[model samples]
Target chain A: MIRFEQVTKRYPGGREGLVDVSMQIGAGELVFVTGHSGAGKSTLLKLIALIERPTRGQVLVEGRNIGRLPRRAIPAHRRQIGMVFQDHKLLPERTVFENVALPLLIAGLRRRDIQRRVRAALDQVGLLDREQARPEMLSTGEQQRVGIARAVVGRPKLLIADEPTGNLDPALSLEIMLLFRRLNEVGVTMLIATHDIGLLDQLSGRRLMLDAGRLAADLGLH
Target chain B: MRIWLARHVQSALASLGRLWRQPLGTLLTVLVIGIALALPATLGVLVRNGEAVAGRWTSVRDFSVYLQPGLPVEQAGELAASLERRPLIAAVRLITADDALAELRTAGGFAGVIDALERNPLPHTLVVRPAADADDAAIAALADELRALPAVELVQLDSDWVARLDAMLAFARRAIWIAAALLVTAVIVIVGNTIRLDIQNQRAEIEVAKLLGATDAFVRRPFLYTGLWYGLAGGGVALLLLLAEQALLAGPAARLAALYGGSFEPLGLSRGGVAAVLGAALAAGLAGAWLAVARHLAAIQPRV
Candidate 1:
């Protein structure tokens, strides 16, 4: 459950990053946010994650206004959401298992429960076999899978991916999208921001398109 | 609760591993802190020994109240008897001028020279031993009171040298404390710098952890513990240095004191004092680590 209500984000250099963007996604829904590079898709996701507050208006998630969350409470808010990046963002020195277990570690979960959840998440992303392998040793697709496993290991209510497949090949991108679709079937709200429109058909659910800092179109869930 | 304990242990061991990975650097830092801690410790031992020596020498302290020339022996006896009646006076022995001259003549090996003198040159004197509780101020005050007597010409206190030594020792103790304070500050800077370098080296990992929702406390735990390790090691080294100094000096000091027919036992640090040193070092290390982390960790943010 994520909602942006007339949110306008202005950068420090007198540039508007997002303008009057208002949208809502129901619970357990998977949506794709498509726009050109720097078209405010990332900004929308950032606002939802509360990493960047709107210059005006409010971004609400799970019925609470995230923009208004106090500074001390930001960690709790962040723990409720899972984020993935295109670069995998894994600690290069850590093993795949350690990277996946990072979220559960931060949550102070029991080692046994963390081990089980981490193995299960790694299994879901088809990375159970490479638990001890470092991210640098893995292929780009495998690295993205590790990132996905990390993002979902904590079972966050809202999952945000910012151009997660931007560095992958077409086939790898499709496979990752299919994995995401499978995750959607098991109930995880997903918001993915990507410029790649070619692989949209395979995971087509809904597409919200942005143009020059404005929500230009909303292709409702089909 | 189990999870919390597990995380604490995990993080602590992880931090220990980090230090173990950089053994040479950590060892160098610890050595620097050890040298710094040892400087003050050495001076502290010096102050203690100085105090012991002063106490030993000052035990024979007394005041010589000399009577005016031509004073009668009966008058001197009366003066000594009155002096012994004072509260500060433990005992007073009266020596008439004639007796003083005769004793000096025997000990000075100048009997023929003293016999040629027309009159005895010495005056009647009262050797006043003070009470055990008489301090430097009290002794000086008693001398002042005695000098005011009609028959008393001069009051010579044998405790002045010891008093000067005591003053110098007290000043030295203060100087040592000042040195200790500066060295403590140096330790803090060393630890703080070490932690700062660590934070800089782990910048990427720190940013990633922040993104993954690691609290400031979690990120800070390892560095704090690492600083404490440095401090504890340094303190242990300082303790060894102090013990080594005492061990090396003990036999020689005893022999030298024996040559002078005095037993000089230089008391080294007590158990509580050693604990205090380690505890202070630990606290200083923790403070330094806290300052460094608080300053540097907040600047690292996950770049979205």
Candidate 2:
């Protein structure tokens, strides 16, 4: 669960990225944040992820105001949130299994538990057999799947995606969307920021729209 | 605690494996670090050895008392016996003028020239060996006492040579300190540059990890371990270099000792010295890595 109250983010050069945005998403809810490029969709996600602090007001996750969190504690706050990028961002030098296991490794999990969770995550993404394959050897769709697996491997409470299917073909994008839908069905809180109107048309969820650095519309969950 | 240490160790091993995958670059980096570390360590060894040699040579306190040329041999003998009775004087030997001339003749290999001389010119001498623990002030005091002797012409304190040797050793120590400081700077720069490159290489991975909830400490652990490995390897190489230098110098040192009619053993590093060298390398490595990571990690913002 996340809540933003009058959150504002300004760039170093006095460019307003987000302004007085008030929004909330309940636990186990699937929401869509749709906006044009530079419309502050990514900035909202960054605020929720604690990557950048809001310039004004507070961003709360799980009832804790993370705006006042110490820099050292930011990592622990982030551990509860899973994030995926449009680029997949899989490490090119490591195997798919290693990439997925990174979060667990950082958590200092036992090697056995790490292997178990990594294999299960890869299985969920339909890449169990390709666990040994490097990201460079994988297709674009497969690499994105690896990124998804890596994001969800630690069983984070919140899943945030930043235009995850932006680079995928229609079929591949649909397939990735189906994966998120399945994850959502299994009770994972999901927030996907995208400009894909067609994909939005196919999904039944809350739509929070942004225009000119402010929230312009909030279509309540269908 | 055990589990934590084990995990850290595993992570360190994983990094070492990654380094091994790029052996050429790793070897080049290690060699650079080694050379940087070895220069000062070798200089330290040299200074210690030189001090050891000086210590051995100065172990005995020697002085010479020149008796009046025409003083009677009995009076000179009596003076030597009286000086020997002093608590600081360990031993004293009286040499009459005739005996001094005879010794010069034998030492100079000029028996024919001495035989051709009209008269003996050497003065009676009293050679005094003081207690080994005598200090400079005490030796000077003894020299003053000998100068006041009725039969003595001049009192020559051999301790002046020891003082000069000590001053030279002090200068050498200061030089070593300067060299060590420069080499330490070189170590820091070399290691810092290496870690900076590593940070660049792993920038994307670091960003991804940050997003996934990896703390700076978690990300920094591997680089810290890598720096430690570099330090440990460099120290090992430096120790080997020092041993090789000592071996090479041993033969020459022995030859010089033979020339001086003394036995000399080339000095090697003591256990504490070795530990100090390793500790210094490790501290330099940790500081360098910390600097590079602190500077670079904060600048990496996860892309929204």
Candidate 3:
């Protein structure tokens, strides 16, 4: 579960990234965070991820105040949450299997357990055959899928994605959305930040829309 | 603990693999490090050799004492006998005016002219060899005592040569230290700059890894290992270079010793010295990597 209690973030240039925004995402719920460019959608997700601290209010994940978390405990806190980026930031020098196994490796999982889990995650992303292939050899969609596989390999409780389909075609984007839907159905809490209204229209999920650094609408359980 | 060690080992192996991916560049980098390490190593060997040579020269105690010109030969002989009675005086040879004149004639090859001179110009002299245990203080005390003798005109102790040699050795030692310090600084800067560039190149990957829950230790392990490899390779090369330099100098040193009718031994690195060199190289590499990581890692935080 994720909760933001009147969270406000201000950048150094006097720009309000997020202004007094408060929201709660329930366990195992799929939510869409829709906003135009520079509308603080990514900033909202970052607060949940603890990448940046909220200036005014507390940000909680799984009932723990992450803003007050000690510096040394940040990594442990992050291990409970998975994140995907628009660029599919996979190490180009590493193979798909290696990239996906990174999280498990950092978690200090046994080699056999890592192999099994990475295979299962790649299979979930329909990238099992491309496990040994390098990221450079994969298409943009495939790379994104690899990134998704990497994010979920550790079976994190919550998954946050920032523009996961920004570079994919319409067909690929729909497929990736369906993949997220499947992941959500399997009881993984999901929060996706995107500006694609068409994709939002196709998915039946709670929606939080932001405009001018403020939460403009919350279509609850739509 | 075992798991942590295992991760570090894996990280090191992964770093080596990355180095191997660009063999030429890695080799060049290692060679540069080796050259940097070799300069100080070679100087160290030279200083050791110089010290050895000076030590041998100083081991022989030679002193010259000049007696008054009108002093009786018996008085000079008595003075030499008194010097010989001291435990520190290993040997004392009395050279009267006639003996001194004869030695000068033999040395100068002017016997015919000396025989025609009106009178012997040299004064009575005493040459004293001190015991091996006699130190600078003992020598100075003995020289002062001899100078105070009524039959002695002056005691010109041949300690100036030893003093000059000691001064030279001290200067050389200082020079070696300064050179070593500068080279170490150079090594740190070179490796630090290289690692900084590497961090820049891998910035995106680091951000991604951090977002995926990789700790700073996990990210830093590979760079540390890379620095270790550079240090090890550099040390190995430096050792080889020093050995080669010794070999090249050995022949000439032996020939020079033969001309002096003495056995020459080229300086060899002691066990502790070798260990110090390796340790220093490793320390330099670690420090360089640490500095680079400390300076650059914070600038690479992910935006979202």
Candidate 3 residue-wise lDDT, A1-222, digit = tens:
889899999988989989999999899999999989899999998888788888999898888889998776877878888899899889988899999999999899988999999999999999899999999999999999999998899999899999999999888998999999999999999999999998878778889999988999999876
Candidate with more favorable, higher DockQ: 1 or 3: 3
Put down candidate 1 lDDT per residue, A149-217, tens digits, no spaces.
999999987889999899999999998888888888889999999999887866668999999999999
**Residue A119 of model 2, lDDT score:** 94
Q: Report the Cα lDDT for candidate 2.
A: 0.87
Give a tens-digit lDDT track for model 2, residues B18-63.
Answer: 7888899888878877788788777778878888977876876688
lDDT, candidate 1, residue A135? 95
Query: What docking grade does candidate 3 earn?
Result: medium
lDDT (tens digit, per residue) of candidate 1 on B33-104? 888888888888888888888887779887788999889889889878887888787999988888899899
Best by TM-score: 2
Highest lDDT scorer:
1
For residue A114, model 3's alpha carbon misses the true position, in angstroms, by 1.7
Backbone clashes (count) for model 3: 0
User: Which window of 10 residues has the lowest lDDT sum in candidate 1 chain B?
Assistant: B1-10
Question: Model 1, B84: alpha-carbon shift in Å?
Answer: 4.1
Model 1 interface Cα RMSD in Å: 1.1
TM-score for each predicted model, relative to the true structure: 0.88, 0.93, 0.89
- Each candidate's DockQ: 0.61, 0.72, 0.62
Q: Candidate 3 regions off by >4 Å?
A: B64-80, B93-126, B144-156
| Model 3 C-alpha lDDT per residue in residues B211-262, reported as the tens digit of each score | 8877888888888888887777777877887788888999999999898889
Of the two candidates 1 and 2, the one with more favorable lDDT, higher being better, is: 1
